[model samples]
Target: MPRDAEDRRLEPFEWNSEESVRYEVAIEVIGEGVAHYSALLNAAEAAGDEPEAARLRAEIGACVEERYRLRATDHEGVTQVLHKYRALLRAPGDHDA
Candidate 1:
């Protein structure tokens, strides 16, 4: 029997459980860190504060390292969230995703 188009189109959310929610929160933290780092970099550039910029850059690097360390030990839920966030970040011309 041919499946209904609507039924075929209805896909379950990849992360819909409580654990997934926690993972999502972690991913959001990582994203926020990225945004903060980017803003600091921009501000440093605008103000021509090379030293401050260097400091912020180091902080950003540390945050990234921490994120990866957590990810390495995270459960399946976190891994799923990380995968989705990475895909969105790497997507072209659409940062809102």
Candidate 2:
């Protein structure tokens, strides 16, 4: 995996208080990896390194697919959170008249 601006590769997603924030971070990670791999792919092509170019191309594809999957998961996570919040709102409390 290509390093991001922070010189870190994509780490496994950790639970965040905010699903939207986590999604944003995951997207940024994918964007960074794709950008780095794109640069490497270009260089490999320029140098006529077919093998490396092929590998970079594959990596880029995987990154894109992962990003797509992450988006769906993020949406579901947000929906689940909203449902829980709504349930709490509907629940009767001791103070309810």
In lDDT terms, how accurate is model 1? 0.63
**Each model's TM-score, in the order given?**
0.53, 0.55
Candidate 1 lDDT, tens digit per residue, 15-92?
Answer: 447756676577686776577667868898899999878877776786566555553235764665566556655665
Among all windows of ten consecutive residues in candidate 1, which has the lowest summed lDDT?
A: 88-97
lDDT of 2 by residue, 1-97 (tens): 7666433433466565576575575566567667767877899999999998998898779767665555424677445434433443355531100
Q: What is the C-alpha lDDT of each candidate?
A: 0.63, 0.61
Instruction: Point to the candidate with the largest lDDT.
Output: 1
Which segments of model 2 are wrong by more than 4 Å? Answer: 1-17, 72-97
- RMSD values, in order shown: 12.0, 18.8
Model 2 residue 26 lDDT score? 55
Q: What does the lDDT come to for candidate 2? A: 0.61
